[model samples]
Target: MNYEFTTVGALIGLAVAIILIIKKLQPAYSLILGALIGGIIGSGSLVTTVNTMVSGGEGMISSVLRIMTSGILAGTLIKTGAAEKIAEVIVEKLGEKRALAAISLATMIICAVGVFIDISVITVAPIALAIGKKSGYHKEALLLAMIGGGKAGNIISPNPNTIAVSEAFKVDLTSLMMKNFIPAICAVVVTILLSTMLSKKQGVQVTENDLEQKEDKNLPSFIQAVAGPVVVVILLALRPVASIVIDPLIALPVGGVVCALACGQIKNIREYAEFGLGKVVGVSVLLIGTGTIAGIIKASALQYDVVHILKMANMPAFLLAPIAGILMAGATASTTAGATIGAQTFAGTLIKSGVSALSAGAMVHAGATVIDSLPHGSFFHATGGAAGLEIKERMKLIPYEMCVGLTSTVVAVMTYVI
Candidate 1:
């Protein structure tokens, strides 16, 4: 493919995909369609485009499998009331005076342990709302606290975005996570500060109507509730901590099983697994679709153009990874897709430019946090719905979320690039 044609096609395809996403088309369909259009335009043949898409989607199989397996742990935590128990303990300890900080920290811990950010927000929303009612904090403030904390934890998490970047850079997942730890902490601090400030600004108060009545059930003991995540963390850490290698695919399901056993939910494992699988099916498809677009971009001249432009401007080579990450995530309104596509397209150039794989992966992973909560993405609506926020109220939280993400991105640059 000619450089000019490929570059033009790639740019046009990305624009179309972003536009379609803004139009409320499903991201998976939009990305796939965009990939087909870009591939055909760039290669000038239908067969070539189809072949490239298949090849691209093939590259995401490992990531897809890891993400799918992660659902088991997520389902076990959410369905068995373990996640809520974890949140309740933290909030109780912190008390109502520290409600914002408590909710933020709880959500951060839950997400860092591997729950999806959206699910984390949903899981913690009720608690946050109840706290808001007692503390006289606005519902929007509580929601922002959870959203910000989730984003912070997400960067260092064993979640899909982290998995995608680690695989793309061929680095140990734990190493990538460790590299992101400081940045994640910085993000959390920012979340707490901003949320506290927002809490004091005076807004609509949480009322009884906003709260859901709880169903009585036998909740797990704290020890049992903590067991599952502890097992997964220990297993994952064993690679770096004890020189015992275990893939996440094995570790995640094992954690789920341990969690169920500890909680005495062994009889319902099949139901939990099914629920987990259902939650991840859409996400799995989204990753595959992102892979196709990434493949198209890789085969085009867009990357070279970006590098040449950066060089002409005398920017550091390491800047490309984060820049690509932020732009793609902003375009897609999804951190996982943005981080995956950015790493897939730029990891090679980043490595060749003298950046280490771990550094490159960390930079991109943090960058994806920026602008990932835009309204076009499901995170915006799902979380807003869970918090019962109006569209306008949700919109007000975007800048705070961006600030949290930017703080993490800056820390990543300092830790890795400087």
Candidate 2:
């Protein structure tokens, strides 16, 4: 309702916020306070600013809930030794030479089937560690490779972003999936190869790990270990086949239950789920804070100015598509947020301007993914946690992400341009 806000002030607020975040303020605090500062500079009153923050945080509870459930599933996999068994089999089958790439590819396969990175990474992490012990791969390279694959799946798969596009554009899910399938394949492959290369180039040293290289053949069978996540994937995919809705919140837990039953960890399943819940607070708060910031900006003069700038840029469809994705994703630290917001704001504009939905989708998917790997993001934090590295140690992770983002964007541009 305030009209007195200046564009320059809002921009200044955002810049200052980024500086503060880089200075290592808590992420939740940084993002929430940054949005508030921006809102105030944009001529919003303290009252309206507080309301927007509350509304934004409240709006994200459902998403946060899903993330928690995913955390629970991830924790269960870790605790059960189920994740270890699967990783062992994959690495053993691929042997020492190809083991690094195999871990990345395996995670990609799981994600391709519909699992979220938040869920897949925790489970796959054990695999990466297993591989590192089995073969002397650089811990950092393995981390980058695993993230690249999971990030690819997150960007390319039929999760929230594509689903949002389908609903908003009135396109069928099948149609959207068909359109994105090839791009997803190409992106996943490129993500694995390029991430590994870039990480190695970034001076990832393969120091000897001190992990016990235990052969757990007597542990749960690989098939049994994989049953939970595999079942979740199948249930998610069968949405159209069964013509019934399947929520990850429902499916993942069911699979978790099965995994617990199989691994015989049923007694502490609740405890395991609780442990998972604790791990995601960092990401969950940041996600909610992003929503809050987004709400405040929407309430400010920022949205109008952004829309006008978008109109004035007049860039090509391929360029603008990824640009749109990058902007939202960089600010929000979420590919789904970036993709959905970009689609809501620009996908229609592109479509109406004669760009094909398939091309537009690829560009958006790739573009949003480019910046979703920012150091402050949930994925970055998750990767660090998975690798048991300090924040400073995790710095090597960025170059690989930057490379993958660049590669995917180039591929999308080429796809659309050609």
RMSD of each predicted structure = 1.4, 4.5
Q: Per-residue alpha-carbon lDDT of model 2 for 203-235, expressed as tens digits?
A: 434434534354644568877888787777676
Query: Which number leads on lDDT?
Result: 1
Whole-model lDDT for model 2 versus the true structure?
Answer: 0.65
Runs of candidate 2 with Cα error greater than 4 angstroms are: 1-10, 110-141, 156-181, 195-204, 209-218, 316-321, 331-365, 375-397, 409-418
Residue 31 in model 1: lDDT? 95
Query: Candidate 1's residue-wise lDDT over 1-418, tens digit each?
Result: 3432388888788888999999999999899999888877775488777787788899999999999999999889888888888988999999998889899999998998888999999999999998888778998799989998999889878899999999999999988988999999999999999998998786767889999896886889888988999999999999999999999999998898898999999899889989988988888999999998998888789888898999999998899988989999999999999999999988988898899999999999999999998998999999999988889889999999999999999999999846
TM-score of each: 0.98, 0.77
Candidate 1: list runs displaced more than 4 Å. 1-5
What lDDT does the true structure give each of the candidates?
Answer: 0.90, 0.65
- Residue 334 in model 2: shift from native, Å? 5.9
